[model samples]
Target: MNKKSNAVLRLIGILLLTIAFCVLGYLNAKNIKLGLDLNGGVSITYQTVEENPTAEQMSDTVYKLQMKAQSYSTEAQVYQEGKNRINIDIPGATDANEILAELGEPGTLQFADEDGNVLLTGDDVKTATAGMTNQNNNREYVIELHFTEAGATKFAEATKNNVGKRIFIIYNNEVISSPNVKEAITGGQASISPIESYEQAQKIASTIRIGALPVSLTELRSNVIGATLGAEAISTSLQAAAIGIALVMLFMLCVYRIPGLAASLALFMYVGLEMVLMQAFEVTLTLPGIAGIILSIGMAVDANVIIFTRIKEEIGAGNSVEKAIKSGFEKALSAILDGNITTLIAAAVLYIRGSGTVKGFATTLAIGIIISLITALFVTRGLLTAFFALGATNPKLYGIKKETKVINFIGFRRIAYSISSLVIIVGFIFLAMNKKNTGDIFNYDLDFKGGSSTTITFDKDLSMMEIDSEVIPLFTAATGGNASTQAAKVAGTNEVIIKTRTMTTEERTKLYDSLQEKFSISEDKIVTENISGAVSTEMKKDAVWALLIAIFCMLIYIWIRFTDIKFASASVMALSHDVLITVTFYAVLRWAVGSNFIACILTIVGYSINATIVIFDRIRENLHNGSKKKGLEYVVNEAISSTVTRSINTSLTTFISVFVLYIFGVSSIRDFTLPLMVGIVAGAWSSVCIAGPLWFDFVILSKRKKEQLSKK
Candidate 1:
């Protein structure tokens, strides 16, 4: 490798550029964001029921409703809320009343018999579709009927003999219009004429054209969100994130000194890059979203480890200062990309299927992966590469050592194996023993329990006593009549969330009717949201399957990319460790400090696994390419040392970002950010000390012994 002028100079230029970005980020740390989930803000999704309509139809209705509603007032910002819910964030509109009235303009179609007696109601029609045609030489937007053949046949018989008689179309218990039927049409088809505008004609055609819902939906969960907790959460996370970042930086300086400073500088760039990626990709920064960013800090350190270790190795390999810098990065590049790439694949899979907070995790994680790779591979490596190019050749000055690559990890297998086994076993036992106390398993959250919550934010604060005595009790009598509050909006104010462990469709309706009376809203304003057991079960299954599949996909990727089973197996095992340890931590935390534990576990799983994979990717290279005389032991040592700094740097930077979130972020974020911070530390330790070394001690050494014994 050339150690001279041009090649070395290029390396210096890149390093300086990366350094500049870090300077910029450090200056802007105060502006970084923390998601609401981490900070305890209520995220409510209000979906208008299908009323026997499709998702597309419901969305269309919501779009129009928002415009119509806004016409009444301009305070509504509409978004596509969960499933079919419409999210309307109205600033200062505590009533949330006028918004509902605009959305729920009743389109009930009352079907009357020959003597004008009602035969059925809009409740009987499931759905309707509309189109255009020329009727009796007049062009009209024709509404077509798709009814339950029963609804269709009765209408056909009624219209067959009354071809020229006026057939009244009463909606909302009022006569909309009456048109004489020119012909009797069968096969569940019908048309109405002289409708309002083309838009209104389409609306009426679609509304009156459809069939009825199987059962009326009532709001089972509705309550004003408490702003009190949100404020507290905001205060808590920001402080934790700040403390965490400072601690990691302090540790790096203590351990690596000059190199540590360089890595920290690199870390700053990583954060800046990560934010740009998140915005460029349009990732929503939710509670789990902050977890991803903070966790990414760890993964980013992993790349730094790879490069730092390689730099150390090249120096040991007897290269000139410049040559060593170039070679170290060249050797470590493949490993850095391989590791981050694998975790990246998992993040991608998650984003595609995960909804709500899950999507947030995947999105931020994926962004972290991309930027982590960029900084570690290009920015950090290029900067280091440039540093050597600038003619700075004091091995002592840069902290290059005479004996850095001689550490042995293969001899510590017994201890590692024993400790790992104990941790895994303890985790399983703890999970099993306390399964009943855990959420969903024991006292599931409303997500699985199938309920609704409405957070009413008054223009001013209200008394909890009044709400409990009036609002909650009214809803309790309405929601399954066994109204229970799993967790009221601990965030005080006029806000609250009402919940029930279970409620059927009828029970939900009755609950809504009761709340309408108590909240002083029209019956229509008390919108209903029903949660079905089947849908809940499916969502549960999907969540589990998605995680498992992500793990499996990652396993196969490591095996195929590295062309070895041992490497992949070790990686999978280490990942399993990260996940289990995370869960154990969560259980202990939740058991002790009542935080949202599951988010922490999931965030840890993703963070740790990414670290392990990156380290393993680097180790595989030393196995395949390093000189053989030094044997597997040397190769393993070389691999670990070569990637060690990258790991440390990645982990440190990731922790720094996480620390920032934990401190400066919010309470909602702390539940996730704090655990994630712990998990990052654990994940780093496991990947370097556990996963990387274990592979050589067991598989590499075992193969050598079998060969020796077979020689006989």
Candidate 2:
């Protein structure tokens, strides 16, 4: 084949693969699982009747509930609350009442005498199975129960004492069955016969098998909650993503020209592949998950920017287009690998350690990172080569790097440190002030602090959009806190549930009057009850531990990759700076600290570390290649100067993506994107100003310590 023909074929092949991925993404979009916040679900809480339940008992119950709920959908989440409550959120479930009816009451199952003296609790049942039995030529469903050795002995003795008398099988203090003791059999098994149908028998058997909760439970509150955000939220987020991607593509094209186009194409494929993989893996998507996907797009762009920057430099150094392309990717490899691997480590740890929502974020993040890496490394390279082979090989087309003097960023290090210290100290001051004024260090939303759930039956059907826009503000205004609304699952009734921070009586009354006056509904129609926070203390602990472990793992990886502990130390210190700064924003601005708080903090940790690694990689490279006569300060300054353009471009593109999200997304999504935007800027600043300087300081301190020791 001629050169033109080969290039045509390659381009066609890339187009075809892109098309295939886009088609698959579109087809599978509906199949992607959405979490409880995105899809309406049954949110039910069960409190242990016992005053104090053992942790073991609660854990066992939570595990059993998780298994049971997963039977409905693999995305179901069952978690423990405060001390003795278990919260089960089964996403995509419409009817709360149906779920309640079939969920089977989790309580003690007692086999007792007619006098009500208990013979055996559910703990004694080893297993339960449902089967058919024939009696007098009629087939009927039966429940077969297998007992533990102790249970068998107890049952045999009970039957012996109550021969020919009625013995009761009870569940939740209600007699479910009463049968005459036919004989004192010593067998370790028994059968409950003459069930109406197989379904009933199975239900009974399942209840018996799973009913062995160490502590009895009572339904505290059961709600069929609608999606936290309405359909508009999804639509707006998609719009933001589309607009952001277009802007990024335009920016790339105007700047990098041909290579920019190739990167854009790769980005499109990245998005499509992300959608397809998420569906294929059955990863649940939530609002925070969406944020993660968008953020990863920015990081994907960062990889391409790094490579293209290197390519431009190579070309400026008088290399051919072909050589530049190859050398560009080669030189960019270490930074790309180090950055993505470190972030991937964080995502992996978060997935393993986090609960439902955090796990969703981690899953999407990991998928995006892997796909972006492939697209940047392989797909973008292939396209650039194809375009080059097709005859667009002019050095000007891909832009020539202009030589510039290195800026002494190290000279300004003291100013940067002072600014950072001042900001962080102010943050601490505000935290203290908040604690003193509000009895909390941050604005804890309903997810963090237990709140009130108000279920109201309206006179007319109000769509979820209406509840979000029209109803939520009323509650928020009245309660002076963030409020989330959910539509009730009942078919005909126009019921909506509003959740907010625990409201005082006056606030409740004010809300009641406002709701009644606005909708002209009767006072009796609305009902409110206090509910515990969805984010538990244990979850908070898990998030903290996960982040710590992830940071440690990333530190080790950076140290090993760069062959210096100083790089790892500098990276970790920069990460802390970013987090602390972001938290300061959260404190000063008083953003609602909810589930998104964890997502935000973890995201900053990942973003900052990746950014820091890029600069560190550059410094490492410069150290080996640059003149040994140059001082450490000159080497660090030159490395930062060379990579400064790449850093700014990447951060700008990322900021553009998230900025659009903030502008176009719903209020809740905006709340999420807000802190994220702050984090992105902080990450950029620290990578440029903080990370390199910190490394320099560490090296200086180490050398001085060694000199002192030698003199001694």
Top model number, TM-score? 2
* Residue 61 lDDT, candidate 2, scale 0-100: 72
In angstroms, how far off is 593's CA in candidate 1?
Answer: 12
Tens-place lDDT digits, model 2, residues 1-712: 8888888888999889998999999987988877676776788889888889987877667755654564455457666666787878888777778998888668778888977788888777766767898878999888787888998999889889998898887777777667778888688898877788887777677677667667778888787767767677788888999999999999999999999999999998999899989888878787777877887887789899999999999999999999999999999999999899889998999887665456666877789889989999989998999999988889999999987468989999999999999999999999999999999999888777767778789888888767766788888789675554333333345877776777889999999999999999999999887666666565677778888998899999888998889999999989999999999998999888888888888887877777788788888887888533599998889888888899899999999999999999877788899999999999899999999989999999999999999999
lDDT of 1: 0.56
Off by over 4 Å in 1: 1-266, 385-391, 404-408, 435-536, 588-599, 614-619, 625-667, 688-712
Q: Among these predicted structures, which one has the highest lDDT?
A: 2
lDDT of each: 0.56, 0.83
lDDT of candidate 1 over 553-664, digit per residue (tens): 8889888987877777787777777777766665554422221343455566666765676556656655567544678777766656655665666676676777677656
After superposing candidate 2 on the true structure, give the runs of residues whose Cα lies further than 4 Å from its correct spot.
45-87, 95-214, 218-224, 480-492
Each model's backbone clash number: 74, 0
Error of 1 at 357 (Å): 1.7
Q: Please, what is the TM-score per model?
A: 0.60, 0.82
